[model samples]
Target: MRMVFRWYGEGNDTVTLRQIKQIPGVEGIVWALHDVPAGEEWPMDKIAAYKELADTYGLHLEVVESVNVHEDIKLGLPTRERYIDNYKKTIEKLASVGVKVVCYNFMPVFDWVRTDMHKELADGSTALFLEKAKIEAMDPRELVRAIAGNPDFTMPGWEPERLARLSELFDAYREVTEDDLRDNLRYFLEQIIPTAERCGIRMAIHPDDPPYSVFGLPRVVKHAADLRAILGFADSTANGITLCSGSLGVRQGNDIPAMAREFAGRIPFAHLRNVRVYENGDFIETSHRAEDGTVDMCGIVQALHETGFGGYARPDHGRHIWEEQCRPGYGLYDRALGIMYLWGIWDSLGRGKQTKREAFSV
Candidate 1:
């Protein structure tokens, strides 16, 4: 398992690439051009600039978190073809800089939703919380306000540009169903997978945040079967899943470790964060450690090791600790701590060198 850190970008993030490089065992940063809107051709010069930045600290530039899919593409709109052309261009640009994996998601409207950004935990350290009652009863606009409350830090999924027209987006998607979303995703994969394979890039789609539908939105990437259906869309090594534990772990029924071993061959990127699931189907993102949340992070790592998942894995969202004020979930202190926790598991179980490509490939 190659450890990675998710850095927003220079100036946009409180944590710097320099600080990230100092973290032990972190081989790269999961990054993207946050300023760029989805489906636009990422300038080669801009891609080169970040690649150069990572090279300065001996970090690899290949493991970027997301290149978001436009709602048009997700809806199978006529304009989607234009956006797809642009996406193909962006993939080629990333290839020019040696990016191996690009993690993107197909969730409509809000990428991920939380009832509260800083739900107070018993330990005093706050975490990104989602209560069952709150999610089922509370308004999405309220959640939106809380997530974007910090004007300084732009939430990656909840972008101001796309979400500002919430009402319209909701109205448009109101008619769309889960099956519609799945069909559109299949359409997207058919077009993009070929381009991705040609560029030597793997497209790892992140599971829906919380691994469920929210605000009445249709979500297709929710469970193991969903992932299995998604991978079977293109039937290529370039099409895969990001396999985030915290997102899928919100539902108690998900067997994260088993899914890792089952999909090991296709999982090129992994988001290793844990969340404590309440009995009522709600959850809160906690530190990477086992005790902090319900997700069996150590067992997940053991499965990764057992399956020889020699790919990029990074600590996902973490709680805010030490009174440190930054992005709601992307704080530095706890995430760095999360990295070491992942390291502890990997060091004990991550025996032998990184596995070669052919080992897990079918």
Candidate 2:
């Protein structure tokens, strides 16, 4: 696996490229033009600048965390074709600068939901938390206000412009059932996957955060069957999935290791993190250690190794530790720790495989 780190950009992120360069085994940065809104073409100059900055740090800009899909495309509105064309252009631009994979999601209204951005853990550090009962009881508008209230950094999905018309968006999506959402996603993939293939960029859809519907919004990319169906929508290597352990692990039934093995060939990107699931359908992001969370970090890495995965991977959200006072989940300290833990497992597994091959050869 090729280790990558997510860097917001020059001024947007507290973690500098210099710091990222110091992290062992990290060879690239998963990035995007965050200032640009969805359904718009990314400025080539901006993309080039990002590439230039990464090159300065001796890092590759190959995997982009997201170039968000327009809500029109997800809603199947008449304007969706225009947005899809814009996405194609963006893909072409990114591919020109050597981007290999683009990670995005089709969750309507919200990309990822969390009841608390800094819910204190037993260890005194705070982590992103999802309280099912709180979510069910709170009005989505209020929830949006609460999530967007973070003064330190702007949350990706809770953009002010998007949340400003929350009621209208909810009303627009009221009739969009799960099946309808699936059809819309298929249409989107059919339109863009071919372009992605031509540009030598893989379009990897991130599974809906939490792997379930929230605030009555329809979510299509939440299960293994859902992932399989989407891959069937376009029978090309460009069509792929970004297997996120924390997101899919929230469901408990999603065998993350099995996904690493099953979708081995199609997966071009992965978000490796763990989550501690509670009995009441709630969860909190945890450390990368196997015992610290529910997911099998070792088995997942081993499965990727067995598949000979050469794709990009990164440590996802991390807890607030060492009084870092950074972004809610994107802090540098904990994620740096996560990288070491992941490298430990991945390197050990790789060494074991090499030893076996040498034994066979002898």
Name the runs in model 2 displaced over 4 angstroms: 352-362
TM-score (all chains, Cα) for each model: 0.94, 0.96
Per-residue lDDT of candidate 2, residues 124-157 (tens digit):
9999999999888889988887888877687888
> lDDT of candidate 2?
0.91
Q: After superposition, how far is residue 329 of candidate 1 from its true place, in Å?
A: 1.5
Pairs of colliding residues, candidate 1? none
The lDDT values for all models are 0.87, 0.91
lDDT of candidate 1 over 1-362, digit per residue (tens): 88888898888898988888778778798889988887788888888889888999888888877888988998878999999999998998898889999999999988888887888888898988878777888777787787877778888888888878878888889899999999999999999999999999999999988677777889998899999999999999999999899998887588999999899899999899988887777788877889878989988999998998989988889899999888888888899999898888877774576734332212
For candidate 1, the per-residue lDDT at 232 reads 94
The 10-residue segment of model 1 with minimum total lDDT is 353-362
